[model samples]
Target: MKSGDAARLMGWDTTRLSRILRGTYRVSADDVRTFCGKLGVDDPAGVEEVARVAEEPIGEGWWAAYASRIGQNYLDFIELEAEAQTLRIQHPVIVPGLLQSPGYVREMITRAPTAVSPAHAEMLVSIRLARQAVLSTATKLHALVPESALHAKFESGPAIMRDQIRKLLDASQMTNVELQLLPLTAHPTYGSIGAITVLSYKHPWANVASVDNALGGNHIDDPQQVSFLEKEFAAIAEIALPVDKSREVLDEYLEGLRK
Candidate 1:
């Protein structure tokens, strides 16, 4: 149970175990088995439970098939997202991937300045579409997108954005989904940081947040940092329009798209 003993059992340097404990690093299935054994949880039932959970696929059929295509870093959050009871997202310049229409996704992908091969682009679009399945059931989706995100143009033009807006409105109407928008003139602090999506769960270990950027993404598990991110989201949420008016907000943008 001691730190040094636990490290010795795992054949890890103390700092390495620290990273796993702090969630700055991830663990392999073998690591899970070893840890369970070392921590006095090796009863047959306990061991089986741990093994089953560690081995269980986060995304069953197709999600598992595309495992290699996903970045391990992003996949880490995806695993949590699949089990999370609630998802909170803040997108500054685009629709949240979970709510994007196929046309919008295709537009954003094929037209990105950083060109990808046609085959690869189509694959990415499929992955995005598949991710929407994770929202099955009454899983609550709370979204806060800025007005600027809605106004941004894609190479596919107004129609793509129109479809995106329509899809977003449909999602907002779902019983378990809530949507809001941060006006362009709201306080600039959170917008400067970039997009964030937080996955919350009943268990603390399953809680995490993902931050996206030009380079890649970050998985934030440090309790204090995650708390700060949650607070920042709250601050922006306060500045956002009330949830009831979200449909009006998206519809307003859709009307502009038609003009």
Candidate 2:
């Protein structure tokens, strides 16, 4: 099967299917029934679950405080990230946002073409940093970053890269964190596709993949597409350095940056 056949079978692009599965779509009982049949499951109760999610008013989350500052696309990720038990990430460009230092994050935001106002940028930074709270919680995070991302110098400049590398090293020490470095030779295959974060929860909710691009991207929950992305991620991880070796790679890069 080609990469997008599952989306074709689902009769929608992965992004739209993702919205439906993520409950962002106006999920009618009829739609739910149809999906249940398609998935070969009997799930009228699933329709009711969708109905509840649609009509039930939600209380304020901490992100609510920065809703204006945080873009809706990221807010969507935040919503799912909060409930996820595990976060498996493939970062090809830079450090994953959750693991980024405040300075690094600020540099990233300020460099954006949209050019946020000073105060507005600070609010967004707070939300981004606040997201690190998930790290201290029960969420188990696994990040596979290529050596190039470690080597990539951004507007935050050398200092931030060093700080970021130090942070990556520190995070690798965390019991719940699994950080690996994909070598340059692996770039043509796994790393070239850029970043994707797979979030796992308990059953029925299943897994969601948030595919990132130059612009913000969509949240996907289609079973087959999620499975495909998972396999792709696994392939990348396979080529990546093991834990100790990943650290060794990091040390080598960090030392190179110092010289």
Candidate 3:
């Protein structure tokens, strides 16, 4: 069968589906389930094989402990980041991973639940910094930050926060990275629904979105769920500040902090 037809049968776009097959994208547990259902495979061993291959290991040591725990969904998320043409993120709490300053990330990890070991947190930080590689590539990134995130200082202290803001300013200068501030006054909007990120991979058959949740930090790729998040993101973006205005607002906040 043609690749497009294969993707349609599996409920994914041809390019993305092919990328998964080619080891360019990570296959998620959900994707494995779908593949099994479509291909009439009864055993899960095949699925596990696919998952293992998709998540190519990097480096050695403690991260290996969590390696098996990193399921297909996580791999798929990495793949989407790799292939995405445009990334739209709305974060209400901490800064999004791609834009996070190392100091800010360190502070957040230190305060995380005791269930997460320091070694694991360090590994996660390493992964996050690696993810930033995509921002320098051809992808177009649009990030929406609530004013509260700017004011919320981390455990790293005020100096770290100052440096973080400066880092943000530096990132804002990138033409491909469009940063916007959703003002505190612009309250009572659709965004009260919670944090969401939409990754759009432009494929020949159709675009795909990977949506993320706040509480559990689960990634959802189901078409219905992705569609709903997309609409909600559009509504929230509409109420957010335009690019130029948002930049001005960010600068004003930085200036106030310097005073």
Candidate 4:
């Protein structure tokens, strides 16, 4: 069937449908269900698969109850992350979401004002860990962490911090992953305002930026924003410690936990 015809059947605008087909915009769970119903996809498994790839794995029962209420951008980020070839993450206060250990994630969520229940927190951790699959893939990961983040302790306590640092050490050992530390003595610059992550795809056409905010986050796809983020990332990488030195730093931190 023609693209326009399929779009019309699904009740989507032709241009929007084209973008989804081209992978420029993410297809949401709702979109998947709508398409399945319109296209006469009756099998339950078929409908579930369509929604599964498009949505974040929120486990079985909970996602169905609250899927429509969540932020669309978060769902889009999940899809973008899955397709990334290279990920450049700059973290100031907390660890990068993908690199965060399960204990750390649980601590953060439980400490929040609207604290998540134990089950929900576990689900979130599962999602975060699943996101790490990209790191194991052929994707190249570059993570720049401010020295302060290393010093800050989560509710998980010193042991958790040590384990988390050890995980970072292991990840850095991988040829595809480079973890850099921006020491506390470093001068402030443009990227100091907030955390940022830039994901570059092997396809050349799929570059994106996840810009941070005090209240929430924003995804940047405009060429100008993407170019600016790329430049900032380059500068941060240049000023941060080299991979070997960064690993040494992490080791030192872990040792201090024992003292």
Candidate 5:
């Protein structure tokens, strides 16, 4: 049977089916049994065992510890980031979270629309630092940041902003990272709308997209939405500076800060 037909028979959307197959989505024992029955699996005993296992609760991931401190939406995004094989991120006004420096994180948190305490702010900074671990792994990260982000003034002043730019320069040199600067001279098609991230997993149909807002953000798993964001990322990359040129932009900005 065709995969599309199988998905339809199970009454599952492509995104949900992909998540379930990837073991990221929860499934009930009845649902597991129905899937096995639909597939005509001969081993009733095996199906029962599989259903039993499905009934067990999934264990909490490391990020679960931060549930009370952060919103559920942000936690969900972190999990997605942890599992993504490649991330395409475009930020119009600020550095991407995974690429943000501790000082930048603290400044952004301080200026957040919803105020947070010092302790909570520190936790958020630690979370951003921890998220950077994926850059050291095989996961590929491509960031398209506008040149204006480097020039944006922060209340904390030049020193922190300088540190932020330096962090971008350092991240640009990583083997698994690609950094592009969207120059002021070149206009982006849709990048200025908001910060968006397209995360693609090892599974062919498991791609997702997210748009960051003042609040946490929305995780979009619809195939059509994800595809549009993917294409938008490609278009933005076309208008952005090349990796070497992007690094040069960072260098110039950092030099300006030093002066």
Candidate 6:
């Protein structure tokens, strides 16, 4: 049908329909239902799917405060993260964002390759720390960090790492979080894989994975690719120390930091 016809049927101005078609309009769920009804799209499931995805409030989200200063990739991850039923993350180089202490976050953001103003760095730090709120929610986090990461050098004094380890220890005790440490002696293959995060949703939405690199991060939405990362995380978890043992290892690292 022509744009004019479709617009008339959907009770929308031609310009409005055109903008929606061009993906420039933020069409609401009610608007979608009207469109589907007028277009004879009786499939409730299809209509609901499109409507559900269309109304996600990305522009009006709390993270919108930092949207201009931060990368869209990071924003996308957090949006999905807030709704994820579970998050499986593997970090071999540094502490995962959700578990990092404020000091660690500050140091990491400041040391990042893409330099930002001091105020901007603080904004980033706040965002990361805020992300940790997911841990206290219905969302469960399964994090895999190599033991070496606990001992990784920080430009800041040992105090930074000490506080970080302390934070990790506290997080490990959370009922909704599982923190595992891959021993240095683990299989080379497990230790070699780079950082990855797989967010699993309740329904309708498929799994999504994010791989970290020098260029901030990259999201993998392909079902097959997400499956591969999920399998890889399982294998790594198989080799990582159990939660109780992981806490013991963290304790050892914290003690060493004191020395």
What TM-score, over all chains together, does every model reach?
Answer: 0.78, 0.74, 0.69, 0.72, 0.78, 0.81
Residue 165 Cα positional deviation in candidate 4, in Å, after optimal superposition = 0.6
Residue-level lDDT tens digits of model 3 in 171-210? 7889999887777777665567667778776432134555
Q: Which candidate has the top score in lDDT?
A: 6
Pairs of residues clashing in candidate 1 = none
Q: Rate the local accuracy (lDDT) of all candidates.
A: 0.78, 0.79, 0.72, 0.77, 0.84, 0.86
- Clash counts per candidate, in order, are 0, 0, 1, 0, 0, 0
Q: How accurate is candidate 6 locally (lDDT)?
A: 0.86
Find the 10 residues in a row with the least total lDDT in model 2. 1-10
| Candidate 5 Cα deviation (angstroms), residue 172 | 0.8
How many Å off is the CA of 33 in candidate 3? 25
lDDT for residue 142 in candidate 4, whole number 0-100: 91
lDDT of 1 by residue, 111-222 (tens): 8889789998898898778778877765788889777777767655678878888998888888888888787778777666888888886532446888996544788888
**Candidate with maximal TM-score:** 6
Residue range with the least summed lDDT across 10 consecutive positions in model 4: 57-66
Off by over 4 Å in 3: 1-66, 69-71, 214-218, 221-224, 257-259
lDDT of 2 by residue, 1-259 (tens): 4425545765778787777656676655565666656666766666556545555456477877666755688888888898799999987777789888777888887777887688887877888888889999889999987676666667546888888888888899999999998877774867666688999985456899999865567889899999988998999888888999888777876787423
Between candidates 2 and 6, the one scoring higher on TM-score is 6
Model 1 lDDT at residue 47 = 61
Q: Write the per-residue lDDT of candidate 6 for residues 9-34, one digit (tens) a residue.
A: 86689998888888898898988888
Lowest lDDT block of 10, candidate 5: 53-62
lDDT at 158, model 2: 83
Candidate 5 ranges with C-alpha deviation above 4 Å:
1-57, 257-259
